[model samples]
Structure formats: structure tokens, C-alpha cells
Target chain A: MAEHTLVITPHKTPRSTNITKYFSLLLLTVLLIVVLFPLVVITLNSFKTEEEYFRNGPLSMPSTLSLDNVRAVWDRLDYTTKLKNSFMISLATALAGVTLSLLNAFALGIGRIKGRAFFLVFFVMAITLPHEMLAYPLYYMFKEVGLYDSRWSIVVIFAVLHSAFGTYLLASVFTAFPVELLEAAVIDGCNKLQLLVRIVIPINWPSLSVLFVFFFIWTWNEFFLPLIFLISNANQTVPLAVAMFQGQRGAAATFQSTAALLGTLPCLIFFIIFQRTLAKGIIAGSIK
Target chain B: MSYKRTRGYIGFLIPGVLAFLIIVIVPFAANIGISFTKWRGVGTPEWIGIDNYERAFDDTTFWASFQNNLQLVVAMTVIPTVLGLLLAVFLYDNITHHFGPRVASFFRAGFYIPQIMPMVVAAIVWRWIYQPDWGILNWMLNSVGLDQFSHNWLGQQDTALRAIMGMMIWFQLGYPLVIFMSALQRVDPQLYEAASIDGATWMQKVTRITVPLIRPEIYVVILTTAIHAMKTFAPVYSMTKGGPGKATVVASYFSYKNFFERPNVGYGATIATLLTGVIILLSVVFISVQTRQERLESQ
Candidate 1:
């Protein structure tokens, strides 16, 4: 069998082409294990008692499933508070950012504003400007304004950081839409604002909704700004809380892993559900 | 057809641009000024005329951090990208040849999950996996009779940055894989069939035909991933904290600590300015290369 026949283009062979097919299957399984291994490792540890975790090492399957670690971590990390903070900030930023960007897109992309090209270039350039570049100045300014700990500060910062992207996304959406329908609405006594609300939002809801979900996830996972702005445990988002935990006291394995697991679960579930759109936004960035 | 312009059009662009200006543009300008001043977070600045920049350039820690970032370019950008292309191509072959929708999407989703996983959570996961005694990696080595190989993966200086790089590769593979797969999905399959008719082998088809066609998408992946590698901070914040004595401290973390932790505001600002300039320069070069290639292709 090893000395066998010969090989040809994949089209000529049938599905029983054992070696290649098996190789492909094996390759995929390897990737699957690599990708999913972290989740499994954390989950397995989270279930085990600390002694069991130590005795069995990290490889052993949990002897018994338990939610004890998750429960303990929930209280320790103030999970609900951080989750609420994360949600509130993410929602506010998404709402404000998306709305502003939608308007900007409509103006420059559809309305043919005077500085359309300039705005487009400017916003696109923001994608390259790492947020770290302005981290300190914003830190000082927020401190001086005495607004650092307020939920509004995080919302405002995330919204502002992301609005340029929103503008760029929605600008493309606006530019590519059929102009006749928009013009028809304008001729039919709908004002610009009314036309945007009545026509564009409904027609482009699918495209626009992707922007919302993408923005929500981005703000939800945001770490650096919230780290600077929302200082207290009470005010910090989940990622910032986790970071402060690691920075201050990362030694506690049981608590930290549990907290990390619980915090990540929401985003994981959300992405699994909307993985297609997430991929689209990512691929959009790649091509752009 | 004539297009009518309305004042309301400008109305649409203002709110967003204003928010950006207030947040990003203003802070950016302020940082440039801040970089030149000899001030902490608060108080009157004594203009120090490039002293902070000079100090930053002289800082040994800054160079050490920069060394880690350069290492990341190979680990994070180059290796993962090469591996991702291979994964995409192989599965793409499976898709075009043997698999149906179920298999295709299953692999696609598996590849993408890591890309969307929050960085903090991912760092937590990997840190556990690299745990010294209790870590699965060391345990696996023991089971495989390679116990001599295992060490504290993210702890010591020699293996620490390298360990982080290994995980970084795993953490980053998804982006390029998904992007390339999407690119492959859009390719003209008839070209492959024609190549196959000409007796093109598997390697030939991939290298000679598929790669050249998907070159633009590949470049996009490289550029984006390169930027991500450069701007990384959360992973450092979570997994290592510049670690078991500064082995994994990349430039972003160096800037972050100087500003916030040490309160060296001016020096921190200088480091940040340098990083931003590098990012902008890289983006300009990448965009020009891409556009120039596009022009040549069009001709």
C-alpha cells in the first residue's frame, strides 16, 4: 500500500483518497484543539478543588463538576458591578458613536459635504493611531476635570475613540446604497434628518446593525482607557478589573482563573452567535 | 445628473468629527506639548526642550522593551501569518475537494474563536497553561517523557518572552486564516481546474497559482497583524506585567508604566510619540506598497 499507485489533482481522486483527507482532517483537529484548549484548561481547573487541581496537575479532567470557584470569584470580583459597568459604558458608547458616525457618513457619503474626502482620510487615519498615544494626556485632562471615575467619562472616551471608525464604516455603507431611493425620499418632502431616519436606517439596518454589534464588543473588551479613566473597582469595566487584579495580586490561581472565565463567557457567547458578522468586520479591516 | 448639496449634509458630519476632535485630536496635540514639558500630571510646565525625548532615548528599559516588540514582529506577525496561510490553504483544499458545508463552517468557526476572545481573558487562559508545576504543558511533557524540557514558561528571562511569543502566535493565527479563506472563497475556481488539467501538483497549485492571486489579501493580513503586534498592551498587562523582571515588557507597556505608575508624564509622552510616529510611518509605507501594487496590476 505504501508503494501504491500514484497521485493526481484533487478533482481526479475520489473521497477515499485516504492520506490527504486524513492529513487535512488531522490538521483541522490540531487547530481545533489549539483554539479551544484554553477554554477547556480554565474550565477544567475552575471545576476542580484547589488540592485536586494541584494533585492531578492541569491535565486531568475534573473528578466532579462544581460551580464553587465561579461563585466565589463572582463575589470577590464584584462580577455584577463590573458587568453592569461594562454593559452601561458599551451601550452608551455604541449608541452615541454609531449615531454620530451614521450622521457623518450620511453627510459626507450621501450628502456630498464640502470636506468629504478630507473627513474620510482623517477618520481612516485614526484606525492606525494607537490609543496609547493619547493615554496620558487624557488621563491628566480627565483628572483635572474631576470626571475620571464617572461612567460618563468612559462612555465619552470610548465613543470618541470609536466614532472615527463608525464614520468610516457607515460612510462606505452610505456611498454604496442606491441614490435614487434617497433622492426620491428627499423629493417626497422628507427632510435630510427625516430621510435618514425613515429611509436609510430601515433600508440599511442589516449593514448598520453589524456596526452596532461590532462597536458593542469593542467597547465591552476595551481595557486601556477604562484602566486610566475608571480608577475604582466600583467604576471599572470587567477587563479593567481583571487587569488591576493581575497587576496587583495575580497570584491567586483559583480566584483569578474563575474571574477570567466568568468575564470572558459573555463575549464568547456573543461572538459564537454573531461570529459571521465579527468575521465580516475583521475581514473588512484586513481588506481596507 | 446634477447632485444637490444641503447645509444639513454638513450637519451630519459635525457631531462625529467634533467628538473625535475632542477626544483624539485634542489629546494628541496636548501629548506633543506634554512631551516637551518638565511636568508631572499636574502643575505648571517648565519647558524642557527635548530633554524627555533625550531621556527616553537614553533609557535602557526603553530599548529592552523595543527588543521584545521586534521579537513579536517575527512571532506575532511573520510566523502566525505563514501558518495561517497554510491552514487556510489546506482547509480551502479540503473545501474545494472533499468537504461539505458542515465541515467547512466547523473549521472556519474554530479558527475564528481565538481572534474574538478578549485579550485579558486569553492572557489568563495562557498564563494558566504555562503554569510551572501545575500547568498542562509541563504535565504533558512529563507524560511524553520529555520532563527535562519543561520550565516556568512565562517566568524566567530566557523562556518568558519566547513563551509569550508562542501564545501570541496561537492567539493571532485566526485573523489571517479567516481573511485568507475569505479571499480564497472569492477566487475563480475555473483557474484551479485549468491548472489541474495542466497537471499542476498540489504544491505547485498552491505556490504558483493560489498564492500569487491571493497576494494582496496576504499583504493585508501581514500589515494589520504587524500593527496589532506593535500596539499590544493588554497581553502584557495581564500575563506578565513586564514579568519575572522585565523580560516581556514591550514598548507600549513601558510607556504605560512610566506615565501612570511612575508618574513620569513627560518621559512617558515622549515614548508614546515615538511609538505613534512608527505606527503612522508603517501604515504609510504599507498603504503605498498596496496602492502601488494595485496600480501595477491594473496596468
Candidate 2:
């Protein structure tokens, strides 16, 4: 944006600024390498057999690309089940979280209910509260309610928990909604529910979709609470499955990298698909 | 506008509030109550008010965990914000001025790749990279003829925390960088032109123009990252598990161990309650400071 307005610079740029510019480029290149090298190494090693890994050295390219290590690791971890579990939990949390946020924000932002400030502060504090603080008690409560070790336990906790931020974001977005539109709808006999479904939500679809993507990805990336809640192997999420392989002490090096690669692939796919939305959401999310 | 119509909106809040109460409010309150009683995983509690808090106050490990958390704040919050700011300014100011915007954005996306992966996945990758004998770090050290420095990066008390901090800084850098870069778009380019016309240096422009313009975003990033630091669990859990003789134990993992491993529910709750207090207190300070800065700016 600033580039167009930079009209006054000499046609031949000054030597000092040129030096600094290249230096910045060099620095960014180094940082990029540092940031990406581990991921590249993991991807590279995941294709190597254990024998290939031991014989050719960690840095060497494999003799031939192979899927044997990938298959072995996937089978050992039962990754298909983990993927299904993670997808179901994340999807449920996103849908429920956005719905809850819409309702709460409607009341707080548009409805201007009594004690809205208290509720706003309550939700803000909830967003800041650490997961560990809620983990133990939720664990005890879920066990008492016979929901422990159930995937739904994770879905419920995260939906409510993440909606705290969702409500906070959506409420701010809602407060800016034009009152004239609502008044016109009300005059046409639109009740509150109809107003939300027919008018407000459609108009604010961009922000709501951004919120949905965030809820989905955040729940998908979660590790701590799921580790505590989903105790059974049948119910474990993807990250938990990968984390259970933490020590992998006696296993071959190829197996660990393969686990890392598999664990990251789903989120990497989401990132590629939702990059722009995620960027916009961060901007909306940071504003007061 | 009528009282009855205003009451209608409260109906929208019932489901949200009900779920919030059950999932967050009730569990939170129960955790606080559990802090005051003596209990294990399976048994009824005995009232033991102040005993758990006292134990935390005396427990050296508890205090060390918090100290380690402060280190994480530096890694996750301070270093990231500082570096992210410089990097953002570089891409926004220098790169865009010299190269095309596409190049700058390509760099931004590359830096942000790490933030998109699950932390557990990142932790696994880094753990492998830091593996003592066969890991890349050791291999690179040997290749460079510096093999003596190639010890177990994660197995030593002296290096484990620092090693994890390095990983965190790498993991955390992209968030603030992206936020600040976007925030920079809101900055008027004319300000930079005017500063240049006045013969101001690049450092001067950054200090006087860029930093002041994006202070709010900086505050938001700091607060969020600091909270993440305080809740440092996944990385520590996967990499070190608070190992090398409690060297990398953090508040969250400490409380977690107490809860499950030790089965000391009361003491775990005490640690959690204290950690929550610290976080809330930090948040209050960030918010108040930010609001005051905004007021000052408006004035």
C-alpha cells in the first residue's frame, strides 16, 4: 500500500538503502529456512525406511521414495479412526460454537440486554482462562455424568469454551450492524428469530464464516483438554494419537517423522484452504 | 423499545448461558471448591482449607515451574513481539519499497507456515531434530566440524528449558508478524514520505511512526501470547514431560502431574487456582495499560 505513495525516491536508489534492503532479504531468507527446515526434514525422513535412515544418514535423500514407512506407522497408530474422531469433534464444535455465538451476540449486541457489560467481561475472562484450570473439574464432572472417555465430552467442552471468544468477536461485529435494517424488518412483522435468520446472519456471513473457520481449526489443533478427556483409544483425536507416541523409544526414527507428518497434514490442508479467511479473522480478532 | 420486547432477547441467551454455566462456570467454581478440600481421584474429600496453598508456597518445584513460565513469556511473548515487529516493518517498509508486494507476501506466507501446524506436530518435528545421536542438529554439528557441542539437547538440565524456548520462539514468531503487517496497512504511507523528506533515519521513522501507530495490535498479540506461554503444556508434555529432574516443569504441567500422576487433586487445584489468578491479573494489567495508552493517544 505504501509502495505507490513512495514517489519521491531517486530513480537510482541510494546505496545505503539498497544495502539495508538486501540485508533484510538475507535476514528473512535465513529466518524462513530456520522456520521451514524442520518440516522439510520431517517430510523427507517419513519416506525413508528404517534401514535406509540408519545406513544413509539423517540428512541423506532416500535411495528411492517409499510408502512402506507411512503404511506401517499409519497402521500402528490406527490413524483412520483418529482422523474420524478428530473430524467429528472439530466439526461439532465449530457448528455448535458458531450457533451459540450468534445467539449470545444477538442478545448482547443487538438486544442490548441488561448486564451486558458484565456478560461481556465474563466472556473475555473466560477466553483468557487457561485450559488446565477447567480440565480437572470437567474431567470429574464428565465421569460423574457417564460422559468420560466419550468424544462428545470433548465436543461439548470446546464448543462452550471456544464460544466465549466467538461471542466476544461476533458481538463486536454485531454492534456495528445498521439499526435501520432491523427496524425495517421489525415493521414488516419479522420476529427476532426471523430477523436473525433472514437478515442479520446473511449480511454478516463473512465474519460468521471466519468465526466458523477459527472454531474449526482451533478445536482441531487442541491437545491438552482432549488428552485429559478422551482416555479410550477408540475415542482419541489425531493429535492425542500422535502425542501418545511421545517416547517412541524403541521405534525407528522413520516412524516418528511419519507420525508428525500425518498429524500435520489435515491442518496443513485446512491452512491452505482457509489462509485468507484466517488472516482476516486475525485482524477482526485483534481489534478491541 | 418496550420492556416486554427487550425481554424477548433474553430468550436468545438461555441456551448459550446454560451451556456456558455447565461447561465453564460450574466446572470453574467446582475446581475452586476442590482447592480447599483434601481428595484423591476416587475418594470423598476432607476439608483442608489453606493447606494446599501453604504447600504450594513451600514447594520449590512449584515456584520453579512459575520461574520457567517467566522464561516462556520471554520466549513466546517478548522475543516474538520484538522480532515480529522488526520483521513486519522490514517487509512492509523495505521489501515493498524495493521488491513487489507479491514477493513480500510470499515471504509472509512462508513465515506463517509454522503457525498453521498443530503444536504437537511441531513439537514432534523439533524433538526429532534435537534427537541426540541421529538427529539433524547433531548431524549438522558433525558436518561443520563442531561435533563436541552436539550433546543431548533435550536431556540436560542446563539446556532443556533453553532448547524448548528456542522452539517456542520459532513457533510463535509468525502470529505477531502477520498481525503487525496487516496493522501496517492501516498506516498512512504519506507519513513515511514526510519523514523521509525531513531526512529522518529508518530507525527514527520506526520509533516515531510505526510503533505508535500499531500499539494496540502489539498489546493484543502480547496478551494472547503471554497467556499461551502461561499455559505451556503441549510442547513440554511431548518433548520433555518436565524432565531432566524437573528442569522444564511449567505451571500447567505441574498441576497436570499432580492431578493425574500424583492423584493429589486438592493440590493440583491449588496450583491451577494460583496460575489462573496470575493470568487474570496479567490480563487486567494489559487491558488497563492499553486503554490508558489509547486515551493518551486521543488526548
Candidate 3:
């Protein structure tokens, strides 16, 4: 990227440039606070009593960080079961969705089979097919099959829903693949599965990882599908629960922030840790 | 170049295609069929061809919701894009040269945290901030001697939709920021140096060079965010529940309400089918425009 720049900064800097630099820093600092302030509010308010929250008016540093609201919200919402269910459902969806896309991409992208273009268009069309159109029928369909109230049902639904994006992204990775790799694998008596398992997968792991992280986070945070598909309290994902509690309780419930913080905790932690990969993943997603 | 195609690829594709069929394609086709019928949430459907569609076309609620969707799209897409581009340009110029990569990235991440937060969580957070009695917005207004300007942000019909739109704009900032900043990084700096030599100021450079250079990224952000806004359901669903007299009803929420709230599955299917058509039309136009641009650029 630096190839574009002709180096000349060794000379004395202008006073105007120095002023602009400090001004930009100040602006960015304020903007950073604006972005972080809400989460900060949640974190601060979650520790305080309901009166303290109202009196503090969203700016009080928590008098002391207490586990009181955490324990309360945890018990009230059956947090343990819901978090476990969310992890299982989202993890399963991500695995199934990403794996499906990899094979689909291998077939349609690397193999260059006949009618691949048609399949490409077919999947692209699937991206725009909104869930509202299919939510009711799929609900009834699952009810008939006795899959209506299970987390696994959502796992299957999200897998298919998100694999469209996965296929779109992974296909790009496979399209630019060197033909020599495939030819060499075939000459070494490797079958198609071997070609994919050993060669294509290893080569495209970075793109696959990107797809996996995004699909996982997306599934974890999904609300509408969980609302439609999972009817029982035991099966609801975290977002569904937060939205339900906030709506039903009208933000008067002291633990609303507590629940919201708990619900967002996993993804927030993941973001703090793997944000670089997440950013790269999003960038990769857009380019394709 | 034998061009002899084996049928092996079909085996690899079976799992994905079958899942797509069961989950997406089957129900999708069933939705189209269902939209033409009169079915409640129950036993039998009476085939009433185009009746639901006709009802939707005449429905005031649907048009009102669609109008709200367009307004939200402008808020979510247009204003956000301009603001995000300005933020991106400022950080790209200032931090990259003056501070460092770490500072630039830290700023980017701060802007992105809300986007990464689940919309449900964000809704709850903003709901507290919009609390009519003790909410921060009203509190600040009172403090600033602008108490007359402050009302229940999410309560009144006049301000409910705009309040939700404001939150949408606030939370949807990071998408365009990342896209444009990333695109701008690729612009050859020699052009900037040459422009500067020709007596161009920073504003001129942005309008003349940076904007033109990152046109594709701008289009992508606009199209994607516009579609997102048009189809948005969560903010309204969580914060206002399309309440205060349906002031905040959006297309997605309208479709959702018909199916879930009213149990009008048939009509909901019709509305969803219509929304899908609009999205597809928009997407097709976007793709064609992008391709045309690409062709021109290559030329």
C-alpha cells in the first residue's frame, strides 16, 4: 500500500498540519466516548440498585461493582439454560453452515461443473428471500415433523439461511485457485473428496475462518428467526429473551440493563479479543 | 482441454442443496402459493386468487409502513454514509500519519462496537436512554435550558419514528466507515501529492479525488444499508413495538405483525412476497450499476 506514497515527511511540518492533527485527535476522542458511553452506561447501571440507577441518571460510576443484579437476572430469566442453548444452536449452525458452503463452493467453484453458473444464480436469489415469507410455513412444516420447538430446528434453518453467504464468499476463494494443484492431486490418485479435504480446504482455511466467525456471530445475535421458530422458553436464544423482557417489562425492570449486558457479553468478549479478525472478515465479505 | 464434465460435483453439493431446498426453497414456493389463499393459523385454506395481494395494495397500513421504510432508509443509508465518510476521512488523514495504526484501528473499533452489539441489546440500551421520565435526552435538554425542545422521544407519534430513525443512524455508522476507509487506503498517494502540488486543499482533494476513487464502496454501502433499513424490524420491534399509534411501523414489522400479531398468515405472506420483489429489484439494479462501473473503469 505504501507503494502509492512518495516519502517527503522528513522536512519540517507546517503549523497548520499540526493544528489539524490535534483537532482530529480531539474529534476522534469525543467520537470514541460517544460510541463507548452506552455500553459504559449499561455496565455501570447493572451494578446499582433501581433507585441508584434512576438517581444516577446514566453517568454515575457504580458505587461498587456488585453481583446482585447479575445473580437476580440470572435466576429470573433461567440464564444458564438459555446461554447453553444459544451456544449449542449457534455453534451447530455455524459448523453446519460453513461446512455446507465449503463443499458447495468446491463443487461449483473449483470443479467448474456444468450449470455451476445456474447454481450460483440460484443461491444468489436465495439471499434476498426474506424470512418473513417463509417463517410461517417453515413453522408449520416443523410442527408437523415434531421439530417445531427444538434448538436443533433453528440450527438447521440458520445453516441453510447463512450458507448462501458462505457459498458466495468461499466460491471466490476457490475460483482463483491454481489449476496445477487440482491436476497434481488427481495424478496422485486422489479422489474428489481427497482433493477437497487435503488440498482445497487447507488452502482456503483463512476464508473459511472468516465465514465461520461471521456466521457464528450472526446466528448468536439473530432474533426474528428464534422468535418465529422456537416457541418454548427453554429453546429461546439470548437476543429473543432480551427483546422479550424489555418489551414485556417496559424498561422499568431494574434488571433490563443487566439482562442486556449478559446477553451481549459473549459476543462483546469475542469482539474485544478477535476484533481484528472480525474486521478483516467483514472487509473480505464485502469485497466478494 | 477435454471439457468432459464428471457428475461428481453433484455429490458434494447434495447436503447444501437439500438443506436449501428444505429450509429456503420449499417454504419460499409454499409462501407464494399460500399468499393466494385464505388461511388463518389453522386447518383449511380457501383458494382466493390475488385477493390477498389486492387487499395489500389497498391497505393504508401497508403504504404507511412502506413510506416509513423509505424514510428510515434515508436516515440509515444517506445520512450515515455522509457522516461515516467524513469520520473515515478525518481519521484516515489524521491518525495514519500523525498518530499511528493502533490509534486509527482503536477509533475504528470504537465506532464499530455498537454495530457488533446485538440489536436487541442496543434496543434495550437506547430504550433506557429514551425513558420518558428520567431518560438522558430529556435530562440533558432540561439542563441546557432546552426543556421545551424535549418531549418523550419515543412516545409521541410525531417524534416516535424520527427517534427510532435517530437511533438507527447512530448504530449504523460503522458499516460505511469501514468500507470507505478500507477503499481509501488503496488510493495511490502519488495522486494526493500531485494534487497538492497543483495547489489543491484537503477539501478539494476529497471532493475531486477521494470521492471519485471510492465510488464503488459508496455504492455498496448505500445499497446494502438501504436494503437493511427497508427490511428493518428489530429497532421498532424492540423499542417501540411499532406503537404510539403505528408511527414507527416499517415494512418488515408490518409483515411480521400480520403473521404473528393478527394471525393473518395469508396476508402476511403476500406482504413479504411484495417486499422480496422490491429487494430483488433493487439488488438487480445495484448489480447492474456496479458491473457497468467496473466495465467503465477497466476501459
Q: Model 2 over residues B63-104: C-alpha lDDT tens digits?
A: 999999999999999999999998898899889888978989
Which candidate tops lDDT? 2
lDDT of 1: 0.80
Q: TM-score for chain A of every candidate model? A: 0.89, 0.92, 0.90
lDDT of each: 0.80, 0.89, 0.83
What is the lDDT for A201 in model 3?
A: 88
The second chain of candidate 3 has a TM-score of 0.94
TM-score of 3: 0.94
Q: Mind giving the per-residue lDDT tens digits that candidate 3 earns over A68-159?
A: 88888888788888889888998899999999999899888887778888988888788766688788889889999999888988898989
Q: What residue runs in model 1 are displaced by over 4 Å at the alpha carbon?
A: A1-16, A246-251, B1-3
Cα error, candidate 2, residue B13 (Å): 0.4
Docking class of 1: medium
DockQ of all candidate complexes: 0.63, 0.65, 0.57
TM-score of chain B of each: 0.94, 0.97, 0.94
Error of 2 at B196 (Å): 2.9
Q: By descending TM-score, how would the candidates be arranged?
A: 2, 3, 1
Number of clashing pairs per prediction, in order: 0, 0, 0
lDDT (Cα, tens digit) per residue for candidate 1, span B63-82: 88888888988987899888
Write candidate 2's Cα lDDT for A85-199 as tens digits: 9999999999999999999999999888999999999998899898888888899889989999999998888999989999999888888888888888888888899989999
